[model samples]
Target: MKVLHVITGLGIGGAEQQLRLLLRHLPVRSSVVTLTNPGAVAAGIEADGTPVTHLGMTGNRDLGALPRLARFVRQGRYDLVHTHLYRACVYGRTAARLAGVRRVIATEHSLGETQIEGRPLSAGTRALYLASERLGTSTVAVSPSVARRLAEWGVPPERIRIVPNGIETDRFAFDAGARRRTRQALGLPEDAHVVGGVGRLTPGKRFDRLVRAVASIPDARLLLVGEGEHRAELLRVAGECGAADRVLLAGACEDPPAAASAGPALPELLAAMDVFVSTSPDETFGLAVVEALAAGLPVLYVACPAVDDLAPEAAPGARRIGESVPELISALRGIRDARLARLPLPAAARRYDIARSAEQLMTLYDQAVHGTPLPAK
Candidate 1:
């Protein structure tokens, strides 16, 4: 089937990386369309042999862009149009319907409560979101928590499907050689007690909390990875926490796989770390946490709906915390080597393999194609 994926812009985030893997591995004719000019994400998609489009949009609500997209979808006669993020879902679904495409699917990757990055929306933007939900046939939530949030936003529960983002667990499996090679390449001390985190420098990520927590741990160094607008602020926070020298800001690495841009690769980085730390307030699904488990690295996560649900049986290395700074400092100090080593990360990660997640998505896509009802949210 000729399938089209519409993403706002394939920035190196968890949802974008998951889509990258799915498009590369799925045995289907797929192309990716980006609303804005493509960057590293597009380059990675191109490397995988999937076609990429930069719709040349200057802003979110480009008027002419809509007809242009509608015409393209009409001409391609696409079997399915699946979208990621808010902008693409809004405009992509609207255009797909205007083009008379049979199916349009949208996946909610981030909880809307925290997804807003800039100015609060004006009235028109809110109206557009409401309209987009009506046009899309099926809505997929990255986690059950997201599904619950989507329902609160007026999406009928029956129209939503829960398909937690999948990871290629094999990519995360413990590799002692990789640990040695990566550390050697980066010039880290052989005995460094590494603490690592992966995410854009965003307020919701609570990276500042991590910096504070790191200050409470002895002989610990931190690796903060990924690129975003908040990089400067994060650096400032590190200084505020007196952790400047103890932190290594990789900015962002230009890894060809681009998988290194997020998710399992971050866990691979965790393989070299003694502990993994995430301070994100309310994660839909702790993809990086699972990746850490897969790499046999213990983690300390701020309690949220998704983190609370991550079965300890799967992540024996995971510890949940309420919103307390003292609690975080204590958690960091309490991570003993034996306890961290006991977490069955590989076994835990095996259950979240992308192959299984893809099959479930494919089933949902098949049903969407025939205008069939989605599972109850």
Candidate 2:
């Protein structure tokens, strides 16, 4: 079927990258429309042989963009419209109805208890979300945690489908040659214990706490893989704690199968690390934690619904930690002193494989178009 995917922006964030990965495995003919900045992930998507259209939306209230987007959708005569992110959901769903497309789907990628996409949730925001939500056929939550949050916010339980965010598992498999090369390229000592975290360097992510925790451990280095407005503050925190030289704020790296010019892709960095840590106390799915588990690295996380919702045996290498710097430091020291070897790829990693997620999504697409009932979970 012909499907058009709409999103707020094609930047290097979790939702954007996830879309790129999903398109690679989906069986239907799919195109993309980005309402704003079409950054690295957009380029990667185009490189993978998909047509990407930039909607050139100036700001949130760009009323002019609505007509333009609606006109484009009508011209394409798409069989279905799938929207991602917040702004896209509101506008895309409305525009799809205007363009006479009835089968519309929205995937809520980042929804937390107090925030939607790192922004504080307000009464007006909820009203707008709920109002726009009615225009779509269904909403897909990336995890059971996000599904619960949506239901609590008044979305009908029947409208919410749990389709967990997935990864190209084999792409993240540990590689010995990549480990040595990546460490040397990043100027890390071969014997030094590397503590790695991957996410937007945001205040909510609590990466500053990770820096301080790594600082307390002598000879430990911090490798943060994403970029954000919080970068300067994190650097200042590192310098204040006298760990400036021990930290590497490697700006956003693409997911694996990335071009050589994109610098070290995420898997290479994962290969060079001794342990993975997620300082964010509020996470929808904890996708990075799953990726780390696929790399066979032991994980210490403050919050990971992806792992927490699963049975303990699903991810034996992952450990949930408390939300304090002292607790983080102690956990790091414990893992370091123990010199834990890389564990086996856990069942959680296999469960969230991208191919499986694509199959589940295709089932939803079939249900939407053919009036077929979804199979029992």
Candidate 3:
């Protein structure tokens, strides 16, 4: 089937990377359209043989862009239109309907209490989201926690489908050679204890807390991967914590597949570290934590609904820590080599394999198009 994916911006984030990975596995013809900046992720998607269109949507007030998007949808004659992120979902749903596309799917990737996209959710925003959501055939929630949040936001429970995010299990599998090579390439000391985190360097991610926690551990070094506007502030916070030299930032991964490369990619960056950390209190799904688990690293996180909701037997490497500086410092100090080495490798792979998720999604797509009853969840 011919499918068109509409997304807010093709940037290197969890949702965008997930879309790229899905395209690699999907057996249908797919194209991408970004409502705003078509950044590095766009390049990666194009590299994978998919065409990406950039709609120069200047601002939220750009009403003219709506007709332009609808025109493209009509001209492309797409069999299905799938949208991702808040802005893209709202506008893409409306445009798809205007173009007379009957089968439209939108994925709610990041929705949390008190915030939608790093901003306080206002009444006007909710109204807009609800109004636009009504135009879609169905909504896909990245996690069960996200489905509950969507129900709380007035989306009918029947309209929501739970499709947990998937990770490339084989890509993140631990390698002794990778560890040695990545550490050497990134200039990490062979014997130093490393604490790593991955995500956009934003205020909401609570990276400042990580800096403070790193300062409390004498021998621990911090490595954060991802790019954002908060880099300067993070640097300042690291300086204030007196751990500037101990903290290393590798910006963002352009092509997520490269993350597993033996070079300076995210998976390699993850390999160079001894432990994984997540300070974000509001996470719809903790993709990074799962990737760390795939890599056999012990994880310490706070309020990660994705990891928390998993069966205890599925992810033994994850530990939920209290939300405090002292607690973080204690967790960092408590991580031992034996504990990290004993992570549940086989169970994690079985739980989060991308192939399984891709197959499930293709089934959902067929059900949406043919108006068939959903299989038992």
Candidate 4:
């Protein structure tokens, strides 16, 4: 079946990476449409043999994009239209309906209790989201917490499908050679205690807390991977915490082929670190947390209901911590001298394997198209 996937932008991010991974494993013909900013992830998707079309949407007020997208969707005659992220969902669903594509679906990749799209919640935004949601046949929630949040937001429970975000388990497996090479490349001592966090350097991520936490732990180094508008602010915060020299910012690792490799990419970076920590108060699904688990590293996270709702067996090395400098410092010191065991990946990680998720999504697509019930959980 032909499926048209729409997304707000093709920037390097969890949702973009997840889309790339899904396209690789999906069994049907697929193509992509990006509203704007066809960055590195778009190149990777094109390399994978999926065609990508960019709509040059200047801003949210660009109504012309609707007709253009609808025309493309109609010409493609796709069996399904799937949208990701917010702006794309709003526009794609409407375009798909205008194109007469009855099988429409969207994935809720980011949503938190207090924040929607990294901003404070507002009534107008809620109305727009709810109104656009009606144009789709189903909404895929990346975690159970996200599904619950959607239900609370007035989405019918039956319309929400719980499909967790996934990763390539084998790609992220720990490698000793990678650890050595990555540490050497980053100019970090091989024996230094490293605390790693991966995500956009945004205010909502609360990376400032991590900078302060690293400062309290003498000799502890911080490695933050990913980029955003908050880079300058993060640098200032690091300097204020007196951990500027101790912190290393690798910027955004966008190429999935390189990122998936054991070479000095994201996998190596994750392996080089002693532990992974996340201070973000919200997430629809914690992709980095799962990647860390797949790499056999212990994790400390705060306010991530996505991870908190997981069964213990799925992420055996995960530990919950608050987003405070004191708590993080204490946690770092507690794990400083301890030798962490590299355990087999948890069943929870396996459940979200990209290949498995793709197959389940195909099932959901069948249900959406033919009104068939999903197989028993």
Candidate 5:
């Protein structure tokens, strides 16, 4: 069955990467469509020989692509239209319905209201999301917290499915050579402890906090590897912390994994790091957290809404910090190697790895198309 996965953009992100894994091994005819330009994820998908359709949409209100997309869906006669993120979910599902495709599934990737300009959606937008959730054939949540958040927002519990985010064990595996080369290239001191950090440089991510956390740790350096609107503020904060010299703000690493090797990439970044630090106080699924674990890195995460619940016992070294620099410093210094190795990957993580996630995505496609529950596996 032909399936069309819809998303806002093909940028390097968890959702896009998840789609890439699906495209790689979903075991069915599948394609990706982006309302925006084909970004990093698009490049990877195309390199893998997967078909990608872009609408060249620069803004959220671009409706010009709708007709073309509808026509394409009609002609392709795809069995399922899987939507990711909010904007694309609305457009894809609406267009799919108009194009006579009944199976429309949406994955909710965020737990928060997704508000803009310090405001929740206007009344009309609220109605629209509510209606869409009710009308959607199925809703998949990357974490139970996301599912709970959706339910709190009015989506029925039964309509939501919890599918934990995963990593590509093969691609995101441990690599020592790449790690060494990456460290060498970075010109890191022989004894400097590396801290691998991932995620957008945004407010919710609290990258500034991370910079501050490591400021007091002599000879410790942080490598932040993502981009967002908060760069200026982060830089200013880093400067104020007096630790800018010790920080390696590697802006927008396209593929940490690809840059080095299995280990050199994100896995390498994660594996190479003496510590994996997540200061993001509110993460939906904490994709990078799990990826760090998959790399067998010692993780130190601030207490977020969903963090403690994620393999709590295994991450016993995991400590929650309450808005204090001293607490952050304490948490960073607390993580030991033995505690990190104890964190066991839950069974649900199997479904997240590229291959397994791809298979589960195919199964979800089948369920979406046929109105049947996904197979138990």
Candidate 6:
């Protein structure tokens, strides 16, 4: 089937990279449209042979974007329209309907309890979201927690489908050669205990707490991947905690399958780490924790619906810790003292495989187009 994906931006975020990965595996003709910045992920998608169009949407209030997007949808004559992220869902749904496309699917990638995509969820936001949601055929939640959240927000339970975000599991498999090279490239001591976290460097992620926790451990070093507004604040927090030198902000790294970029790829960085931690108390899906588990690293997370919702045995290497610096310190100490070796890849990793997710999504797409009944959760 011919599918067109609309998204807010093609940046180096989970949803964007997930789209790129999905495009590679999905057995359908697909194209992409970004409502704003077409960044690194856009390049990667194009490199993978998918056409990408930037809508040049100036801001949330850009009414002109509606007609422009609608025109593109009409011209493409897409069999289905799949939207990702908030702005794209709203505009893409409207545009698809305007273009006479009835089967529109929206995947809510970053909706949290109090926020949607790291921004506070005001009444206006919810109103717009619910209103636009009515235009779509189905809304795919990245996790069960997200499905529940959508229901609480008044979305019809029948319209929500749980298609967990997936990863190319083997790409993240731990490599001993990569570990040595990455550590040496980053100037990390071979014996140093590296504690890593990957996500947007936002306050909600509580990366400051991670910096402080690593600072308390004399021999532990913190490696933060991904970039955001909180970089300066995190550095300041590191200085205050006397761990300024120990904290290394590795900026953003693209997915491993993407074309080689300047920085170290995610799997390489994962190889360099001893353990992984996710301090965010609010997470729709803890993708980084899953990636760490795929790398066979023991994971310490304050909240991860992806792991918590699954059977414990699914992620044997992941441990849910408390949401405080002291608790983080204790967990890190426990890991250090135990001298835990790299873990075996977890069942959870295989469960969320990109190939599996693509197949699930393709089924949804087929059902949506053929007016077939959706399978029960």
Off by over 4 Å in 1: 112-126, 253-268, 303-306, 336-339, 346-348, 370-377
Candidate 4 lDDT by residue in tens digits, 1-377: 89999999988998998999999999889999999999889989998899999999999989999999999999999999999988999999999999999789999998888787788877887799999999899999988899998999999998899888888878888898989989998899999989999999999999988988898888999999999998998899888888889999888886366235443678889989999998998877888988888888889988666567877766778899977889988888887868676667777667768888888899998888777888875
lDDT of 5 by residue, 255-365 (tens): 522232332356555555767778766667777776766665666776444355556664443455665678777777766323344244543244456665556556777
Number of colliding residue pairs in model 6: 0
Model-by-model lDDT, in order?
A: 0.74, 0.94, 0.85, 0.88, 0.70, 0.93
Task: State in Å the error of residue 240, model 6.
Answer: 2.1
Which of candidates 1 and 5 is the stronger one according to TM-score?
1
Question: What's model 6's TM-score?
Answer: 0.98
- Model 2, 216-325: lDDT tens digits are 99999999999999999999999999999999999988784446674788999999999999999889999999999999999999999999999999999999999899
Q: Residues 1-377, candidate 3: write the lDDT tens digits.
A: 89999999987888998898888888999999999989878888888889999999998888888899999999999989999999999889999999999789999999987788678888998889999988998899988899998999999998899877888788787777878888888788988888999999998998888989998788789989988998999899889988999998878875465333444766677788889999999988888888888888899999777677777777877889986888898888889434356355847556767777788888878888776678976
Give the range where candidate 4 is weakest over 10 consecutive residues by summed lDDT: 255-264
The lDDT, on a scale of 0 to 1, for candidate 4 is 0.88
RMSD of each: 3.0, 0.9, 1.8, 1.7, 3.3, 1.0
Span of 10 residues, lowest total lDDT, candidate 1: 255-264
Winner on lDDT between 4 and 6 is: 6
* Steric overlap count per candidate: 1, 0, 0, 1, 5, 0
The lowest-lDDT stretch of 10 consecutive residues in candidate 3 is 254-263
Measured by TM-score, the strongest candidate is: 2
> What's the candidate order when arranged by decreasing lDDT?
2, 6, 4, 3, 1, 5
lDDT of 1 by residue, 238-303 (tens): 788777788776665332365434332454466677788888776777777777677777778874
lDDT of 6 by residue, 18-96 (tens): 9998999999999999999999899999999999999999999999999999999999999999999999999999999
Q: How close is candidate 3 to the true structure, as a TM-score?
A: 0.96
